[model samples]
Target: MAGTAAVVSFGTASAQTAPGPAGTAAGTTITNTAQASYTVNGVQQSATSNVATFVVDLKANLTVAPLGGNTPVSIGETDAVLKFTVTNNTNGTQDFILSPIQSLLGGVFAGDNFDVDNIRIIVDSDGDNLYTAADTATYINELPADQTRTVFIVANVPAEQAASLATVTLVAQIAAGGDVTRQGDALVSNGLAANRDGVVDVVFADNDSGFGDLAFNGYGRATLAYEITTRNVDLSIAKSSTVISDPVSGITLPKAIPGAIVRYCLIVRNATTLTPARNVNLTDLIPANTTYEANSITVGGIALGDECVLDGLPLSDAGGTVLPVSGITGSYDATARQVRVTIPTVTSLLPVAASFRVKIN
Candidate 1:
């Protein structure tokens, strides 16, 4: 009798890359067969063993991570974005349902004292990290295994939320994948159940996220803070008048008489700290029965004691001047009988003055 030998060959079905043993795709069939060949009476003969097969199980996992540390916002600001990244750690294609939760607990960030307004959840459709109108998908679509997508939590800052901080959390839940046109149902894990042949079994392997999201629940979460960096400025205006000269007295206790030249000063001050007043425009209607003096409009003047010295450049009544003050413009409206002064900014408690002269008619 001659020696007999048997050979076995194992074949695994084609599979997509996934997070599992040998990176095999879920529901893929692995087959193995044994063949025996031997010489019987100097003739060659062959026999084959039964084929055995098993399917790959599914591993459902995902994670949500904040892309940036803190998002700085301003009071009354709109469309402020807080970015995060969603990664599909599942063993197959998966969809994710996104939820943005406002955290009242302040332990996530220091000084979490407020909540943002008009909160919205958006997914990045174009792979760009920035938030825009084009990024309109509300839920994560079919994301392949080991792929990551960016998401945004947009909100509006309330007008009263000044110098306040708020915290927000982004939560992602694993859902059914396969359809590209719509979101699938939320996935439920089949825990420690017997693996069925040719059927994909679900297993949750995600770790417990520190932000109140538990592990093996097919869910993940991350938190971020929105900080108000700039404070709202408080502005107040004061107007005063002084008689420069008159027909009766000149530069000395001048009375309000005919042909008297009266100088008016409009001062604007910002009382808030850490923020400056911008685009400050001052308008004053010329007093009745008075004529505006030609080239008497001056802006960016300083206040000395109780007098407004026209140390700034003078502007004509028509809004033109040979020399213009820095970031200051003055004009007189002929029809409205008003004096207009535009100051670019007022930054401190020190007042900025807009001065003009009118003669009693």
Candidate 2:
């Protein structure tokens, strides 16, 4: 084996002659040119020579095509067609990789659902008449330079997920010469941005016991119960009533007989982790022969005063009561979180029982 020697030099030299007889000197100027070359595998190759260097932008551009029609696709539903195109801008061929950074159907409200599947890709390029699965990866793949490729994303919106509105984002990237360049992500709208405003109705079941006949010095009292029911959602009772009353029997002396008074009480509680503010109203009807009587009603341990009687019964001062039992209506107390209503006693006519309804707001 022979050793290798390398030579490196700089600058040029010119020859000069010293002055001869008659003090005259003659000289010739010489021009030298220097060149550098490189060799690989014993073959000499010309080096790149340029006064100014040009830059090639190897970034990829991605854009989404508008969705076709007005077919509503809900959450948890799949195969919804999404169209998009990708372009490479570079002097030479470049390869791009594409993938989803986040779930397209993420951030859905409770009870909302969606699905994504069935990805398809089409590429326009030369030198490869045939396309392979490696060329078009559904979720990830490489794209060639100065070329355009089309990708389809199928998404589904389920009925439960269809109620609330949401947004999904998709992204793609490219790399060249060990350097990576990323394209901006695209946003896809699910079109469910409005409030659903679903309402739930309250169902009431009644269990009432009759008040027996009252005599000269005897009075009867009855107990009534109500059950309210609702599915998944909370039920609110706004107002209710039982107009029927108990009839009184024969009496001897015309003494002062206290009229019938129906007292109402309401209890409300928060059923869900998300606490709700509620307004409850209770109303009761006055029965025949029964005068509205003044009485006390208690709610959540709060004692209601004589003013609790509604609709002008000779029980207490008729106006400006704390519990406003006037006009067969009463409002919910936010601070107390309960509702109480009382009816005043009336002059004895027949002593009958009355029914009423409660409303929750």
Candidate 3:
């Protein structure tokens, strides 16, 4: 008498135990067995099926998410940093290839008008969630399952960029993990009907992350925006009039009456900004029934108490007068009765004042 051994395959039932983000670990061996008792052996004969085992395949998955909504940046800014988080959801350790892509006109990030310059991808080496000179690793290395790493998209804004908004997407591609010193090759899915014996295969189970990235591609992506703030110089004009002398009340308490000399001051101030205001031109018209005071126009005057001290250089009434020290130009038109002053630049540190005198008719 001899005992017979039989083997039954349950590929469908065993596939449920494959490795995944939350399932069994990759390279783990799973075994199953089947038992049968035949009627011919009613006296008590049973046969045990052989073991059917297969190694759990690797499931590559990851997710990328922006740390915040929008990264506000100013024009001509350099080394601007945008943050993101990359999580390894695979059942085993993995490496991620990081890349930054500028978005097109529309899609997940609507109204994307410009592209950033000098774009680069960098991993947070110190786990501080901030970009520093010490953080220089470009790709994620040996990131364990269920662990997250911070990443940065560093770029520079163009000096003459006119667009107000720019969008960038960070894409992380799953790669093999093992070596800690160098990056590994990118993972490719092994499409097979049955799991290979004693071998670890790969399967992509990631979800779509917009920007035309589809699921099951071992790629995860997230989008961030760079919003340009209004950093141009803010120019403010303040005008004040002071009577120099009057016929009835001379110098002590001047009044704006006939035959009185009056000075009109226009102060142009530039608020603090990234850049200074240039080509600042100011114009003033003589009041009705008033005569222009010859050679009365002063440029770059300083404010003393409430009156514009004529500390600035005087201009010739004949027109086309340029101040040598301040580079300020002034002109007067007798026919039009107008005074014009042109300043090359207005900065935040000081205010430029243009004052002219007119006499009552």
lDDT of 3 by residue, 34-134 (tens): 99986664586789999999899887777677786667776767788888888887888889999887744243344566788999998999898999999
Q: Output the number of the lDDT-best candidate.
A: 3
Worst 10 residues of 1 by lDDT: 7-16
What is the per-residue lDDT of model 2 for residues 1-361, given as tens digits with 9 covering 90 to 100?
1111111111111111111111111111223445579899999987544443222221222222222322233333334434444443222233444443214234322221233343333332333423444443443234443354554443443334223332232233333322234322222221224322221111111111111211111111111101111112242322222122222322333222342223432323223332222222344343344333333322322222322223322222132233454233233333344333432311122111222222211
Q: Relative to the unseen true structure, what is the Cα RMSD of model 2? A: 33.8
TM-score of each predicted structure versus truth: 0.62, 0.25, 0.57
RMSD of each: 13.8, 33.8, 14.5
What does the lDDT come to for candidate 3? 0.76
**Over 4 Å off, model 2:** 1-71, 74-76, 101-136, 139-144, 159-166, 176-361
Q: Write the per-residue lDDT of candidate 1 for residues 1-361, one digit (tens) a residue.
A: 0111111111111111123322566777899999999999999999999999988887787767778667876676678888888888877888999997765344445566788889999999898799988888999999988789999999988877444777777888999999999999999888678777778889887756343555578877767767788766778888889888899878788888999999998878888764566667889999898998877888667777546866456766776643544556778898998888877667775678778899998
- Predicted structure 1: lDDT: 0.76
Name the better of 1 and 3 by lDDT: 3
